[model samples]
Every structure is written in structure tokens, then in C-alpha cells.
Target: MSQQAADEKLELLQHTMMNWWVQEHFDYPWRDSSEPDWKRLITEVLLQRTNAAAVKRLYVDFFFKYPTAESLASAPVEEVEQAIHSLGLRWRAQYLPGLASNIADGVPDSSDELMKLPGVGPYVTGAFMVLHRNTSSTFVDANVVRLLGRYLGFEWDGETRRKKWLLDHVDALFSHGYTPSEFGYALLDFSREVCGRAPQCQSCEARTQCAYFATLEANNRALAQDNS
Candidate 1:
């Protein structure tokens, strides 16, 4: 695609994404700007390979019991495990205290130092940067990678989200009209809602413009002709 065409598509995506977020995005406590950095970071950890709805159900109560990183850090591993047992991944409960211990010192100002902490990785760091730090970064998880890869029609040999081309593309998209947090959240929600592993391509709002949808439609048409 030419530079001009890519810019136009990005603009349209930003407009469409922000609109969807305004109307359809799920509300999460961690997305709240007023939430403390520790809570936000912990929420990200909890969200990994766990459903957002499950996290939502226990978030307030979990935080109320612990309140701060220092409090969580001091809590027994067994207690922490029981606290988040409903979220599953019982093994993850063991790491909570160590993660909290690291954050009890304070959420590190530098991304490098922050990632050194337990359970903090690119997705978590990116979320912190865009949502809390008000910086431009792309928060990529499976949902995000699926969404962007399908919409933009990109391929990578390994870890699509971590690849420079994908990250740069997402960062560029976020640096434009929409705030990264808004766009990032929209990507996450939309991917889950409309563009899942078995995407609802026909019903998706961006069907006409989405590369994946177009490809699917074309394949369907060819199949129909062959059958006929």
C-alpha cells in the first residue's frame, strides 16, 4: 500500500475504533485512570490467559483485601492463591507475592526496570506506558495480534506481536488521532467481540474494509463458483 492509502486507512480505523469504544467497549476497573499503578499492573498480570469477566468479578474484593503492593507482598502465598482461586491458574498465585514485592518498592519509572519485575512483560509494560504514562505504545496479546494481523494482513515468522514491523505499525497507528489507551482497548474488545479465532466476518462492522473479511469473502465466492 502507498503511504497515502495507509494513512487514510489508519484515519478511518481510528475513527471507527473510538466510536466502537464509546458504544461497545467493556468497562474494567484497571482501565480507569484514577486507579493506582500497582493495581493496574496487577490487573494486567491477572488478565493473562484469564478471562476479563473473571478478573472483573474479583478485582474490587481482591484489592480491598490487599489494598497496596506492600500489603499484597506481605500476604501469605496460600492466602493469595485462595484469594484469586476463582480466576484459575493456581500456579500463578505463587508468583503474586514476588510480583507485589517488587512493586512494593514502587512501579519502576523505567520500562527496563519495570519488566525486570515478575509477571511484567511487553504487553503489561505497554499497557502501563499508554494508559498510565500517557505515551504511545502498542499493547499486544493474542487478541491484539489476531486483530491487527487480520485487519492489516501481515505475517511474521515468530511471535508476531514482538516483531518490529508489527509493533512499529501499531505504534504508528496509535500515534495518530486516537490516544493509545483508547485505541488499544478498542482493539482488544473488538478482537474478542467480532474478530475471534472463528471471526464473525459477515456481521463485523469493518467487513467491507477489513482485509481478512475480504479474503474470506473472495474464497467463499470462488468455492461457490467451483461447486456450481
Candidate 2:
């Protein structure tokens, strides 16, 4: 597709996806804006390399024990580790304290400042800014990368060079009128449910415009023709 045509299609896809997300939004504890910033950050950290459903199970008890940055900062690292041990992150215990200490004063609004915290990489920093500070920043995690790569028909070899390309396109996609937090969550849910590792393209709202789906359809047609 031409660049102009692709951009227009992406706009339509975003609109369709946003509407679907509003109707079928997943209710996660961390998505609650009423929750404390420290709690959200903690949950995000626990969510890394861990199943979100599993993190949701431990969220309430985990926050009740360490509700604030100061509280988590003061807690013994071993105890912190124990609380999240089920998340399969043995080293997260060590990282949590430093993150808490950095945010003990206040959560930073800027990405640079946020990145200074332990475990506050690009994805976390972008998430924190959008969720906690209501800021516009581009942060691409594995899920976002995969979803966008397929949707946009970009062939990425999983190299650092491709990250910039992914982030740039993601930033453009989010540049539409969608609120950062809502759009972020929509992307998360869509990636998990519709556009997963093995995407459910048949039921996808944007399948008509999805580059990956087009490729799949073409391949299936070619295979059927060969068999005939």
C-alpha cells in the first residue's frame, strides 16, 4: 500500500479498535486510576515476564502490605521478593527497593527522570507517565511491537535498529485523538485477545485492514488453488 493509503487504513483500524475496546474493556486492578502510584508501579514491575492474571491474583494483598513508596522502600528486600516469588522473578526483589527509593520522594513526570529508577525501562517509564501522570510518550513493549509489526506489515528481525522504527510508528498511531491511557490499555487488550502470538484474525475488528491478515488470506487462497 502507498504511504498515504496505509496511514488512512491505520486511522480506520485505530478507530474501530477503540470502539471495540470501549465496549469490551478488561477490568484489571492496575488499570484503576484510583490506585496509588506506587501500587501501579509495583504491579507493572510484577507484570514483566509474568502473566497478568497471576499478577492480578496477588495485587490486593501485595499492596495492602506495602501501600506506598515509602512503605515498600522500608520493607525488607527478602520479604518483597517472597511476596512476588510466584511471579517467577527472583531478581525483582532486589530491583523493587531501589525503584521504591527513587520514587519515595515523588513519581517523576519526564521519561528521563523516570528511567533513572531501577527497573524503570522505556516500557515502564512510558506506562508510568501515561497511567500515573497522564502524559503522552511512546513506549513499545514486546506485545505492542508484535501487534504493530503485523498490522503495518513491517518485517522486523528483532534487532535494536527495528525498535526505533516500531516506536516511531507507534507514536504516530497514538498521535490520533485517543487518550494515552485508554489507547494504551486498548492496545494491551487487543494484543492479548485479538492480535496475539497466534492472532484470531477472523474475528478481529480490523482484519479487513490488517496487513498480516491480508497475507494470510492470500496464502490460503494460493494453497487452495495449488490443491485444486
Candidate 3:
């Protein structure tokens, strides 16, 4: 497709995805926009590579015990490990306290500085920077990647160029109004419920504009005609 055509298609996709997210994004304890920076960081640290359902079960008590960066910073490494024992990566939990402590002291102004921490990676650090500060930078976690894959009608064998292209599209689409946080959460929800691992094309809200769902439906109809 031409560049203009591709841009128009992506805009339509964004609008469709936004509506579903407005209604259905998960309301988790750690998702509160009002929460302090350290608190959010703690949740993200614990959530990394762990299941969301399992995190919901443990988040409250874990937060209650180690509520603040200062609290976790002073907390024993063993105690932090015990708190997030179910999430796995006990080593991550151990380093989390120190990371939180630095945030408590001073949240990093630059993405580069944020990535300098022990537990911070490109995705994790970028996510926190956008979510907390509402930066213009677009994010793509596992969920966003899945959503983009399905939306773009690709099997998505996890290629770097593919990921970059989608991220570039996101940046262009959200160049003005939408915050990166909102777009991130929307993609996260759409990937999980609407677009899904096994996409529900029939009931989906974005079937018209969704690259994957539209192609799938067209294929099904063609198959039916051939059988007829």
C-alpha cells in the first residue's frame, strides 16, 4: 500500500481500538493513575513476566507490606523476595528495592538514565516513563505486540523491523492528542480481550478496520462461496 493509504488505515485502527479500551480495560489496583511513582514502579517490577491474574491476587498485600520506595529500600532482601515469591524472579525483587530507592530520591529525567538501573529494561523503563509522565514515546509490550500482529494480519514471528514499523505507526498516529499511556493501555486491553490470542473476528468492534479480522472474514466468505 502507499504511505498515505497505510496512514489512513492505521488511523482507523486506532479509533476502533480506543473505543473498546474506553469501556473494558482491566481496573487493577496498581493501574490507578493517582498512585505515587514508586508505587507504580513496584507494581511493574512485580508484574514483569508474571501472570496478571496471579498479580491481582497478591498485589494488595504486597503493597500493604512494602508500600513506599523508602519502605522497600530499607526492607530486607529476603522480605522483598517473600512478598513476591509467587511472581518468580526473586533476584528481580531483590534489585527492585534499590531501584525504588533511587526513584524515591529522584526519578530519572531521561530515558537513558532510567535504563541505567538494575531491573530496568527498554520496555519496562519506557513504559514507566510514558505511563507516569505521559510522554509522546509509544510503547509495545507483549500485549501490544500481539494486538499489532493480529491487527496487521501477520503471524508475527517477532521480527525487530516489524516491531519498529508498528511503533513508528503508533508515534505518528498519536503525534497530537492521545497520550502514550492511554494508547498503551488500549493496545494492552484490545490484545487481551478483543484482538486476543485466538481472535474473535465475528464479535469484534474493529472488524471493519482491523487488518486481521477483515482479511479473515473475507477469506471465510470466499471459502463459503467455493463450497456453495
- TM-score for all predictions? 0.83, 0.89, 0.83
lDDT per residue for candidate 1 within 1-228, as digits (tens), equals 544455566666666666776788577888887888888888888987688889999998999999989999989999999999999987878878899888776687777787888777777787777777767766777777777677777654447777766766676567676666677777777767777778877656666677887888899999999999
In model 3, the Cα lDDT at residue 124 comes to 71
Give candidate 1 regions above 4 Å deviation: 1-8, 155-158, 226-228
* Cα lDDT tens digits for candidate 2, 8-127: 777867886788789895889888878767778777778765777888888889888887788888889899989888888678899898888887766776788878888877777877
| Residue 171 accuracy (lDDT) in model 3 | 60
User: Candidate 3 on 135-220: residue-level lDDT in tens?
Assistant: 86655566666665566555655564246566675565555456678876776667667766677777776667777777777899
| After superposition, candidate 3 runs with Cα above 4 Å error | 1-4, 89-91, 159-163, 173-176
User: What are the lDDT scores of the predictions, listed in order?
Assistant: 0.77, 0.78, 0.72
Give the poorly placed runs of model 2, Cα more than 4 Å off.
1-6, 160-162
Using lDDT, rank the candidates from best to worst: 2, 1, 3
All candidates in order of TM-score, best leading: 2, 3, 1
